[model samples]
Target: MRTAAVIGTGLIGTSVALALTRRGVTVYLDDADTTAAATAEAMGAGSMAAPESPVELAVLAVPPAHIGSVLARVQGRGLAHAYTDVASVKARPHHEIQSAGADPAGYIGGHPLAGGERSGPLAASADLFEGRLWVLTPSAHTERLVLNRALELVSLCSGVPVIMDTVAHDRAVALTSHAPHLIATIMAARLENAADESVRVSGQGLRDVIRIAAGDPSLWRDILDANADAVADVLDTYAADLGGAVTALRALGSADETRRKQAGADLDDLLRRGNRGMHAWCGNRARRPPVFCRCP
Candidate 1:
């Protein structure tokens, strides 16, 4: 791509601009916050000036709720030949775009499966999306040229392309990203009133569980709201599992031997289920066992 506009100068947007600029694409950076745009420009992400005319593509790096309105407004002024977004949610923004009467053919849904807990222009990095999966959701009306432009953008950012339908994409991210963030936040919230002695001796497991809890709550709120139903569905299973674990733990400490014995069995089952999950993917394991270890 010769030219493109990145409409948000925050982490993902600026990172995209940096990546594109590194690859020799003329990138125009814009943000509602002038300081953010200037910061991105200073960091060598891209130029803050508006494009002379409609460029090759416009990447709307705005919040999920604002994508449609922003897209409609930009399209009104002929912002680019094609467009996509980096919002966490998909269906809502696509619906909003249609509602706002933006041309559907020139747009596609995009979400790069990469980020950090930190945000804004200061946290931007050119390699943030490198080697990560960037999902593209193209509708029946999406033009091949528009899809090609988006794929080129992903290639420029060193991301692998994965095509999915919009609804499936929303549900998948809700399970993997949205629900997990909420779980991490809820877990981390336990430390707010924790004793210094308790927190000071924390282990890697505790740190890992709450790592993503540091994300900006306001931005997460918008993402959760956009994909509320799907996230709720995933959280329901977590709630059920949590309840089971609580029940088993309480029973394990009961006075009755029979109850204690049954509780031990129940807890064993719970731990084994998690063990299976862990066995499925223990990051970067060099060799694989023929089968999962069944012994407890």
Candidate 2:
């Protein structure tokens, strides 16, 4: 906990380094792109110089696909006593480590449920993870010291720790983060070919829905590839809902009054269900009945 090395100087890595530095932990920063590490160092996140010896912990903030390789490389060099990662997917990375014949006792899986469309050291902020849920996935063979080091890192970053199994962590993110990110990108893609007049009239609702679509496509492709099954499960349900909405939209012009009425009812039900679901993140106030209308 006294000293740490951040293996990637991108947004999450730099943010973590900055937070740790602010907390008085000696942080040594590194990245494949030396300029990135230098940028973080210039921002006062940490020193770019290699540590004289092994640090207390090492945090891998690389892409999911590179996590295992980077971990093995660092561990082989005795870079740090314990290690963790901030990759979005957990299950695949754990598998990769096992396949690489890396020691699991010194490693723990982690994902900080925070970040924005912006990336790189320039976009990093010490408070990026504040009040966010940072998940940790520990295997049966994972050492208590490694897990404790990860928890300490999370604590220093002002994150709320939620322990979960690797598979559960993957599935949860598919529902909460990955699926939604894809959904946003899909929505924003529509505007690429949209009529100028149509796009010109867009409002806050459009911006809000498509905000995350600005994320790097290559990075998202890696995340989606690693957790394809879990993400597909969530998207399958969304596809069904989309099909039903399309049917309802076509029926709105039906010749039969009954058909139109049924379609209206279906659309209303979908809207109400969405309102109810929003309560999960929006808190108890969202659960209360509308003051102006008692209807569900």
Candidate 3:
């Protein structure tokens, strides 16, 4: 696209802006937090001044809860020819926009499967989405032009586009992204009251597991809340696994030899399952999906 507007100058928005700017797209940046917009602009992501006319596309990088209203407000003003969002949750915003009576013809829900523990424009990078999966969730009412514009955006950002239904997208992220963050947070929280001696013996495994736990909590709160049902379903399964693990650990101390032996087998099973899962995750990363072409 020749010109584009990024409505939220936070990490994803600014990073998208940076990528577009690098590709010679004229990017106009805006945010509720003026400092964020200025920071993005100063970092050369985009111009902070409002666009004099409608751009080819607009990226809404706002929170999931704000998507509907923000979309309504922007569509009301004829913000862009086509619009897409970078928010993680899709179903919530999709319904909200529909309920708000906003036109879906020019809008598609998107989420680029990349980010860091850090946030804001300062943490943004032009290559943040490089080689990552960028999901496109087009409503039944979404126009072909809107989908094409979003695919072009992904291509410009050097991301792979994967089309998915909104509900499936939400469930997938809940398992792959949302639950993992909460798991890390729960694991890391134990360190808060942990004896220094215990923490002092920490290793790379501990750090790696808890690294994502260091993300912005307020933002996480909104994300988790936005996809609570799906996340809860994931957590429910994990909770069962956790309970099993605990029972096995405690069984290891049993007086009965059979109980102790069974516990050992249970621990081994869990560890092996985790190893297999990791292997599958790694295996998938080496395989790239077919690239979609840019719009004519």
lDDT tens digits, residues 1-296, model 2?
Answer: 78999999999999999999999999999999999999999999999888999999999999999988888899999999999999999999999998887788999999998887989999999999897889999999899999999999999999999899999889988998999999999899999999999999989889989999999888999999999999999999999999999999999999999999999999999998987777544553324544533433
Q: TM-score of each candidate?
A: 0.94, 0.94, 0.95
- TM-score of model number 3: 0.95
Off by over 4 Å in 3: 287-296
Better of 1 and 2 by lDDT: 2
lDDT of 1 at 36: 97
Check candidate 1 and list the clashing pairs: none
Candidate 1 local lDDT, 1-296, one digit each (tens): 89999998999999999999999999999999999999999999989888898899999999999998899999999989999999888999989999998889989999998886989999999999988889999999999999999999999999989999999999999988999999999989999999999999989879988999999989999999999999999999999999988988999889999999998998899888888777665432334544544433
Q: In model 1, where is the ten-residue run with the lowest total lDDT? A: 283-292
- The collision pairs in model 3 are none
lDDT of 1 at 106: 89
Task: Judge candidate 3 against the unseen true structure and give its global Cα lDDT, from 0 to 1.
Answer: 0.93
Q: Evaluate model 2: give its lDDT.
A: 0.92
